[model samples]
Target: MRQTNEEKINRLEELKETYDRFKEKPFQLNLKRGVPGKDQLALSEPMLNILTPEDLYQETEADFRNYGVLTGIPEAKQFFSEVLEITADEVIVGGNSSLQLMYTVLASKMFLGQSDKNSAWAKEKVVKFLCPSPGYDRHFNATEKLGFELIPIEMTSTGPDMDQVEILVANDASIKGIWCIPTYSNPTGVTYSNEVVDRLAKMKTLAQDFVIMWDNAYVVHHLKEKKEHVQNVLETSKSYGTEKRVWMFCSTSKITFPGAGVAALGACKENIDWVTEVLSDQTIGFDKVNQKRHVKFLKDKKHLLQHMEKHAELLKPKFDSISNLFGNYFGEESTMLEWTEPNGGYFVHLTTMDGCADRIVELLADIGVSLTEANASYPYGVNPRNNSIRLAPTSISVEEIEAAVKAICLCVEMVSLEKELDSNK
Candidate 1:
């Protein structure tokens, strides 16, 4: 028999009765992260073996061990540069973590300051950044830690609300930058449309030194048939004469080992030169040894595409399982629950009825399922809607995903039922 929304509500009430029985036990299961599962890790084992000491004990024509290539070896930079569709000179190869590179760039500006720019952020009376809502928490945290005021911008399926963004940038001289994840944005998985990207590229900011911190983390992590790729901001910026207005970032954290993979920064020559000036004071250079390994393993675009297919093979099942669960449990319902079916990337953004997220999250936690904090996606840990929740299906097994989704649906149902009851009262 097909269950109507009311019937589902009743069924959920019954499930809650069953859940109440187990409330006394301590609950623990983590579906809160977007890290790759163990199966995905196995795919990168070949790279490990390829980089062993025995494989290159003696330095070949290109030295792997020592250090000295501040801009990275030509071949390594060339290989990764292709991934961004930019030239080698426009890319700076960094050590394992892209997050580290992002932090370094921001910190350098906050402490050491940029060349041809003002002194450190400390000298400014107030510095502000445009934070797209329901964004990467770590990005927000980085700016907040440095005392920059974070102003939240609402996001649409196409992209951040550009009208408001332009207003903010055009009027606020203190608004120094905006953080963007153009492709497969963290929890939402919504790719920025070309129109949105173009508008951003052409914005006339009040601050001359304003920047768009573009974190293209999932540029190649597609789950379904390929969608249209957004134009490179580096290229788009140049077309609008805003070449120095963007700093693009990417990494192989998902492709290879997260902590041990190489990362890169793509920007205009002026921006790169400014970054290099401060970077000289920071460290000698990033890891060149891993750079050689990445270049050797992922030799060309063909190799990269083939390797990513392996990741897709492992990831698709997990996403499918969770999506199936959502459909099975809520397809017929007209309740205030909604979610995005993302084509790629690591998360599904879910929104419940207003003021119900915290309750639903608490219910799940009480029943042996853990989720990312309900408001962790929003700026300053406050979701204005109080309803958005991020679902990360990458780390757990398919079976665990099934179990977690079942528990999550029950919690959602309970919250919806309670809301319905309150309205009736």
Candidate 2:
């Protein structure tokens, strides 16, 4: 039976007692970022000693210990090519951070321009990039730092609302690009469907040199038996003569050591040549030693998938715990509270009742549980509804996950009840 106003008030009092009990417990848990735990990091420990002196001087004999191989060694390029399913010529094996590579791509276009015509976006009157909400904060921060006005687009289950994307881009010449996490999007774990990919490929834009920053960070990070395969954006755009519009990025940061893993960017021939030419002045090359290390450790796509399965084995239980706890606490009887059960990504996005997210976060913090800041997923650090909270269950242990999630559920229910009772008054 649905609870009456009086019943809700009584429930709030009971929840407050539990909340006070939580405050008395001595524990500090941080779930602010999606990071691989110690166990996950331990899985890649063997890679540190996988190489030797002779291994460094491979078939190319390019001298891994020396400077040069500006765009990356041929073998490194080939490895990432198979990973991204793009041609070897289309890949540029970069340094440790894919985020850095992404920033470089945007900064390159902002200053030097995207083509031979030298149409620098920095010279333009106003430039904007479409950002899908409940998306990655770093993506928003990157473009915002580059002076591109960040526009929030509604993120649907399939992907960003393409109709809205199409309408906005078709009318605004100043809208230069959009940030996309195509497969297993950050926080939401939304993989773009074929229709969404097709619409994005064929969409008309006022800006002739518009681009798509495809950050496929979680491409192979699957948590279930069934893997999702998004349509080939590069091929789809090629049919529309929009091949130059796609700039795809990926990295083995999560698979191996985050601070030392290899990253790469995939693009059309023109983009490859353009970025290569631009990068020439910037550096001699990325860390070839680390590149060779990852190449030998991960080996091929099959082995890479095998490696990720290990990650899933460790992560699946934590995610399952979160799901089961949510069902137990916030069951069908709950109102105006929901969350995404992501398949592959590192976050579970929670939506609390309106005006309740901030309070829920505050309440959890009081009990020594730290979460990602409320509204950290949106552009400018603001969710208009103020109802979104991102939960990262990757870094902590399974026991900590259960404790944290239970505390979260209690706080969520308490906050919701408090809101309901206040409104009734």
Candidate 3:
């Protein structure tokens, strides 16, 4: 399989011709988003019909219309508590979109500070966060918008490099928090192990009120027959008297309608009370009717699993298609590219040859194929290595995934070859 100088040149020419032929087609293929496809969205149609004339009131006897339940309805608290495996008293259901909730949490800290320590982030000389790289960009952006310095830690197999994390937090009080997508992490899809969780819960930070933004956005979003387990960070926090240290966030955005789904936060009593107080000033209540629809459809943990299983069935094939392309189209084993074929979550983490991601994305875009912009997974939208790409396989059809992967592989090879040629010269 070794190619000589002449052969590599010929292969490059052949790829250019093939790419040109694809460009001649009149269709545009977009794989840029991680949104649920129409078919996936349709799965929630049953929820729309789950509510009827017989039930306008919750079991707690709270009316769905009038503003009464400040945090959430009793049943919603019960339902989310079961799903998150936390006590009902610890869960606070909020409006749709966990991203919005996450931003709200940060905003509250920046504006009002936590109840116990009222050092507003804006007043701090230098507020910083330990960001695990190859992470969710939105999380980084939230901190960035408020002007908190983001210092990235290397992502290891088990989790963020603990040695680096422990050292940094121990030395600097300015490092107030870390952003983690613990279960089935956003782009890379590696769940944090129990040992990592234990260390985080016990880690020493100079800041008395250090926070851990544990965005468990994909806790139940499984994509394999054998589901993965992410150790409960919040629960572990209790043992260290750090129960108020972590803020856990999740939503039914993927489970039901992303546009109208409900979100929840799992925390200790202190954190829960603080957020409730701040949120009360903002609004009387979140949408109870929407919460009712979700509770009616997903009655308990078992029903939630059953519903997620359907999403897995619809998504697995698309994931397999990307795997096949990695082995078949790119190579059975490629040196030019590397990726994480996650067992769960919505993305496949792709890393190209050094200094090649931006070029590959640009090359693909010229041919009417769209992907997430390069460096999107990192803080500041700048992948220092310029080699990482997040591939969202669950939103498109099998055919679209195939086409998109082919084009992606083509651009990958194209950029890699160009690099090799330049080095030789």
Candidate topping TM-score:
2
| TM-score of candidate 1 against the unseen true structure | 0.93
Q: What is the C-alpha RMSD of each candidate to the true structure, in Å?
A: 2.6, 1.3, 1.5
* True-structure lDDT of candidate 1: 0.83
Native-referenced Cα lDDT, model 3: 0.87
Cα lDDT for residue 20, candidate 1 = 86
Error of 3 at 192 (Å): 0.6
TM-score per prediction, in order, is 0.93, 0.98, 0.97
Angstrom error at residue 396, model 1: 1.1
Please write out the lDDT profile of model 3 over residues 1-425, one tens digit for every residue.
76676787888999899888887872377777678888989999988988885466656587878796888888899999987789999988899978877888888888788853557776788999989989988889889998899998888888899999999999999998999988888789989999999999999999887999998888889999889988888889899998878898899988898999999988998889988898899889899888888998999989999999999999999998898888886675677998788889899989888899999988888888887889888888877799988887677799988888888888898888888887788
Error of 2 at 172 (Å): 0.1
By the TM-score metric, which is better: model 2 or model 3? 2
Candidate 2 collision pairs: none
Q: Which stretches of candidate 3 lie over 4 Å from their true place?
A: 58-60, 116-118
Q: Is candidate 1 or candidate 2 better by lDDT?
A: 2
